[model samples]
Target: MLTPTPTIEKPSNLVAFAFLLIAFLTGIASSFQLPTLSLFLTQEIQVSPAMVGYFYAINAIIGIGLSQILAKYSDKMIDRRKVILYCCVLAIGGCLVFAFNRNYYWLILLGTTLLGLGSSANPQSFALAREYADNTGKESVMFSTIMRTQISLAWIVGPPLSFSIALNWGFDWMYSIAGLAFLFCGLIAVTLLPKVPRKKMEQNTPLQAPSNNQKSVIYLFITVFMIFNCNGMYLINMPLYIIHELHLPAELAGTLMGTAAGLEIPIMLLGGYLTQYFSKKALIFTALWAGFLFYLGLLFFQNTWQLVLLQFFNAIFIGIIATLGMLYFQDLMPRQAGAATTLFSNAAKLSWLVAGPIAGWLAQFWHYNTVFYVSFLMIAIAMVCLMKVRTVN
Candidate 1:
């Protein structure tokens, strides 16, 4: 009996590089909308706070439920590129709706749903990277490196561009620009991505089964959930805390938040390199502990400058946590790339969905400071759990 010769895979550097560029652009466009969209809804559309919260919650709920379905469907489909192309189109349409519509509730709901679909690009991007890596015999660390680089690039470019556009041309132009960006990404997706052939089932293949110890993945998911809850709490409540609790002016609040975002870029860039020397588990635990300390410092923050300084540290810690956590999770499930990415993404969304309302209620009743304390406690707990995690390698 003759042994079957193994099929050799060819390298596609052009394909891999193009996918990374697209991912970077997609992230930049998405981040541009983050700082201003809520304000636009509340101030321009005259939507109530409660309604804004509800809209965000609904977006999270839909995204979390739909992500796995989309991932599984993409796995079954012959062409993953088509799924990505359609998602980009939906994002563009969502942007158009928000840009043009005067019906506040309808527009907000449609736009949020579109944002959810657009956000789907995140996992899909990782899936694409994983496919490329598997085909070319590249290490999984390269995928994490690409993701961190893209995220850092997006953070550096997005805020200033959005702020400038909003300042000169108004929020309408911002939405229009975001829509154009999405359309551009859609076009790139359709033009650049080749059809990837579906994999055939084989006996004793690495991709055939889940790894024996998946509980580590579960712990990583829990840690991601905790970190994201802290993130969501900060995003939802930070401005209010600065304005209402700290009595800072609106311009100052905006400036501080922008500065925090700017600080994240360097930290994230450093994270890509640091993960090489440091244990992923140690990096994550340290980030959580540092974030907890920053949150605790918020209690004693006296002046605007103190809060600003804390935010800088907060950004650094959060940046490290996000990058390392993602790398760790991706390594844990080298086979189920789409499912793993979807699971981690959904865990973050789940954190936000649960954290948002509770943070709002805590602010309403106790105080914003109380919310921070609760967040700090959660991070502390997460750090403990993360310390218990054993590295998969």
Candidate 2:
């Protein structure tokens, strides 16, 4: 049954703007760390590719556990303001540690793990966004789209800035900048953000209960797992590919990552409105198909410009997934907002957990370019799995 759209008041512009600001600030800080992570591990620390994967896998593994626990607490008891503030503190401290102690592999791993644990902040932020939607009786999907757009905007700015800083000053300075951003985010959380409580919706509320069967749920999980598995592979290897394989400038890594993310900003902003005309299934399926093609193209690109152009396709796929994937999960498990969000979040984490070691091993044994073939295969399989999802309409 299609529930009538609620007539409840919408969140004030001020409230929505605050969430956007937080998302942008957090993105600015973390962008410095993530895009340059592999470069630091491989170039600065002189670690083997396999060891680099191990470090990332360890980080993802720890993040999976910590984010899940934090998600549960954010759903049930904890104030999200406290949770977000604590996460920023951990991330800031981790970045500072990495900046100073990166030469020590053990310390690097420790700092990365702390950063991973702080990842709970993202899901908690999503949970808070949902709570605001609930209070205003607005659709959670709308806020999710808006928040994603803002994050994309930050990515557009962050990557180039990070790359420039790394090129001119040093990678260490990049980490220092990221740490300060987190510190600023912590301050914003304390002063500007609200402390809204999670209220229980009545049974008759418009929120639909989860309706997917076990098989359907399994297929969605596999599809999400595959999507992020490809994501994990690319994140772990793209720097090496650009620097070592393509013989491009190291800073191009940030430029490419930033460019792709920038393209997503428009798509994310429009995604909610697009769904009004096209079915969500069509959007997701088309994105998956585009992803398959994008990865396939990666196997042939011989120049930096070709690779940069191909990232537009990649950005389209990621933007759609980021904006719509959670909404799809919520449609599947509509009763539990936190659980729905975390399911997708953990899918990415778990994929990173596996992909780090596996992608590293593949790149080591074969060619770095061959990793894209594997990613192509994963996307193809995900597309096949996505076809099996039963639509509510």
Per-residue lDDT tens digits of candidate 2, residues 270-357? Answer: 7777887886778888788778878988888868899899988898788898878877766676545665677778887788777777
- What TM-score would candidate 2 get against the native? 0.82
Q: What is the C-alpha lDDT profile of model 1 across 1-393, one tens digit per residue? A: 111222133236656666777777777777777767677778777888877777677777877777767766666555566777777888888777777786866765677777777767767777766665666576656455656567666766787788788778888788888877777767766665555444664112343124554767776788888888888888778778878878878676666666766677667666666767777787776677778778888888858778778877787677786666766766776655666677777887799787888788899898876778888778877876686666764
Clashing pairs in 2: none
Q: Judged by lDDT against the true structure, how good is candidate 1?
A: 0.71
lDDT (0-100) at residue 166 of candidate 2? 85
Every model's Cα RMSD, please? 4.9, 5.5
Evaluated against the true structure, the overall lDDT of model 2 is 0.74
TM-score of each: 0.85, 0.82
